[model samples]
Target: MKKSGLISVVAFIVSVIVTASSLFTASGDPFPGPVMIAICIILPIIGLLAALISNKGALKFIGFTGNLLILLLSVVVPAVSTLFWNQP
Candidate 1:
């Protein structure tokens, strides 16, 4: 995979670990939850974009735009969810 792909993958894995850790534990810890939510929402979309850009031709642009849409939707949908989730 390319650099961007590698970054996206790492970001995604980190996001997952953060999410699991955050979920199992209670609030009032040193770290914040929104940041983790942001990571989880953004990284896979980034990975998709990176993979699309690396493609030879044809649907590269389309794939990027599609991923962007996914990104936007992911952000919008989860923005509220994390807020409620982190709270009791």
Candidate 2:
């Protein structure tokens, strides 16, 4: 396989693993419930698509976007959720 193909495959695998780990690591969860399961399943596919579309030359750009999205969803989403759910 070409370098780009290898990179894309690696990116897809890494993204899927990270997503799975995060979903499975939540304190109260043995398995991710339906919604989390869906997100975990979908996000890596999206990341793979992004990586494929951008080509290996733009892998960094695709990675940055993926990381940013993960950070936003994992950090910002929970903080905002806490504010609303735990409001005075």
Candidate 3:
């Protein structure tokens, strides 16, 4: 469980970085950005899976919440930025 929880934390952090970078690159083109966003989705799911495999209560809760936030940020941040992109 400890090992799995550690993996989850690492994946979650990487996911966040990927999501932020995706947003940072949103202005020019959407090619690599989209790919990174896909990664953003993938990493958290990986984390969640690791956590589930651990089968510990606290890690499970943390994993679920972190996974949800990572997924939410990946999608919501891009959408919100796009919506306000032209506002200046």
Candidate 4:
């Protein structure tokens, strides 16, 4: 694979891992939640953009998949959790 493709793949992998870890690591503290949310959103965007700009088909697929997973982890999962698990 080319350098750009490799970068895209790396970005996709790293973003997914970081986003997922942040989501799972969330605590009751107000500060960490927002910070994790920001990390979850930003990293996926970077991965998605990197994927969109790539010239390789496989890399694009990997990137988009990672972005979608991140979206679910960062947005949908939290919303569901809040709907069902909010402790207040």
Q: Sorted on lDDT, highest at the top, how do the candidates line up?
A: 3, 4, 2, 1
Best by lDDT: 3
Stretches of candidate 2 exceeding 4 Å from the true structure: 1-16, 24-56
Q: After superposing candidate 3, which stretches have Cα over 4 Å from the reference?
A: 25-38, 55-61, 75-88
Question: Tens digits of per-residue lDDT for model 1 on 5-87?
Answer: 44544555555565556557866322566665566566657656675556444344444454455455556667777878975
Error of 4 at 27 (Å): 7.9
Q: Which digits, one per residue and each the tens of the lDDT, describe model 4 over residues 2-72?
A: 55556666766766666556546656323466665665777677767777777868778887787877778
Candidate 1 — which residues are off by over 4 angstroms? Answer: 28-30, 55-88
| TM-score head-to-head 2 vs 4, winner | 4
What would the TM-score be for candidate 3 when compared with the true structure?
A: 0.61
TM per candidate: 0.45, 0.42, 0.61, 0.61
Cα lDDT of candidate 3 equals: 0.75
Instruction: State the lDDT of candidate 2 residue by residue for 1-88, as single tens digits.
Output: 2354445545555655666576677575444577554454455555556555554455645554564566466557878889889655
What is the lDDT, from 0 to 100, of the residue 73 in candidate 2?
61
lDDT of each: 0.55, 0.56, 0.75, 0.68
Worst 10 residues of 3 by lDDT: 28-37
